[model samples]
Target: MNKGLYFWKTSRIPGKKQGIILAVLLAIILGSVSGWYYLVYIPHKKHDEEIQKKKADVANKIKKIDDFYEGQLKGGGIEQFTQLLNEIYQSRMILGLTSYDEKLITCKPDSCTFGYEILKSHVFNVQKKIFWGKEYSASFSNKGINFSGIPSNLKDNTTLTNYRKKRDVAAVDCGRLLNYIYAFNSISDKSDQIIIAKPPASSVLDVESEVKSQKKSYGLLFSTWSMNAKNDPIHIMSIFERQAFKESFIIKGMELKSKALKITGSFVCKSGK
Candidate 1:
């Protein structure tokens, strides 16, 4: 007999046995496929979904950061602050008031250099014949420019007395002036007081030299002299004193007069940080 023909004949099985064997093999394969789908594929699919959700969260956070930076760029950043300073300076110039030179202005994150000027006065005057007023004196406290002056011998001249009363009232009502002074000083560096000569006693020429000088520094002046009043010549003598300060200035340990007047002014220019 031939070898190949003998092996083929032995390998053949009966019909019923062959069908049963095939069915058992098919069942095993189907069970294995079902197990793989439930145990491996399902878990892997869920993990992939979680990863995608995390990626979406990260993307949203990055977008928010980008939007914030974009908004800052559109707001003009430091340029807006600089423009505010310029407007303030222009307003001062229009009012015939002194202001810091534009070229000299400097800004930082928390503070800026915008020039300021303050004029504070203490005046005492006496007239001999027309108004024989007794010695008058006034002093101010650190609390906020209070004026307390004593005037005497006003019973004979009601006009002079009335004028003196009016002057006194005006002097004490310096709330506006004090507001500006305190506002500027609060933002300044009170380094030193600048001293300059007092202006002339004449009404017309008094502030001429002082304004022209433009000292650009802070100073205080005290002077006393006898000068004829503009219209009256009753041999008047007056003592006048003034305290002035420039921008970026500070007062040495000065307190506010009342709690009602809070310091509300702020710098117009600031750094973009």
Candidate 2:
């Protein structure tokens, strides 16, 4: 009986050491899983959400472009209307273009013009104004061209309340404004001349306002546009101004001013044109 007891003790499997090793392995696996969830899976989920949001935003912008054309056809067409279409075509090209030198591309001619004329008739006015010892060609930067023109008193206005909202407006406004500027710039480039102009002072008004109390004069419309470039994405920007006043609106000769505009990103274009 004693010999049997001694054999049993000697044969007892090394269960204590094996159990300890198994427990340690299980603990390690649980810790690794927890770390993966916190460091990788959660962040990946958040990144996907952000991407979806941006895609939605791009989709909405495309819809707005389509709607504008629909409305243009519904509205009657005059020579001015033709001019507007050309402007939009050019503007759209400028939308994807990334250059301060104004090399416009990425638009079909017809659509840009449609948008251009409508945008142009409402947003710019040229008047003689004294600023820093000179009379300059001036129009208002569209309310959409950032809050640069927003009066300090109106900083809290519904539109000027936030940078993101203002930036969005700038993008849209840039698209619309580029239409006219592109046409003009195209001509200027072909002729090898550069035209300098400035945004109108706060006081510029629609001449039609004086003719009839009930009728409203044309006003500036601001819009935003963005580019989806594979490498360097750009937000081509400009503010559109419309002045439907008499043809004598260009009385004030062109002047140049050096007010700094805030730019947030990069753009690439083919040429200086």
Q: Which candidate leads in TM-score? A: 2
Q: Highest lDDT: which candidate?
A: 2
| Residue-wise C-alpha lDDT for candidate 1, range 1-273, written one tens digit per residue | 589988877776566688998999999999999999999999999999999997775555444433432221121112232233344334335322322111212223233222222234523222111111232222223322211221111122221232234321111112333454456446643321122122212221223234324311111111111111121111111101122322111111111222111111111111111
Question: Which 10 consecutive residues of model 2 have the lowest summed lDDT?
Answer: 263-272
Predicted candidate 2 versus true structure: per-residue lDDT over 66-113, tens digit per residue: 343222212211222233324433433543242212122222212110
Query: What lDDT does model 2 reach?
Result: 0.30
Candidate 1 residue pairs that clash: 194-218, 194-219
Q: What's the TM-score of every candidate structure?
A: 0.28, 0.28
Predicted candidate 1, C-alpha RMSD: 26.3
In order, candidate lDDTs are: 0.30, 0.30
* Alpha-carbon runs more than 4 Å astray in model 2: 79-273
Worst 10 residues of 1 by lDDT: 231-240
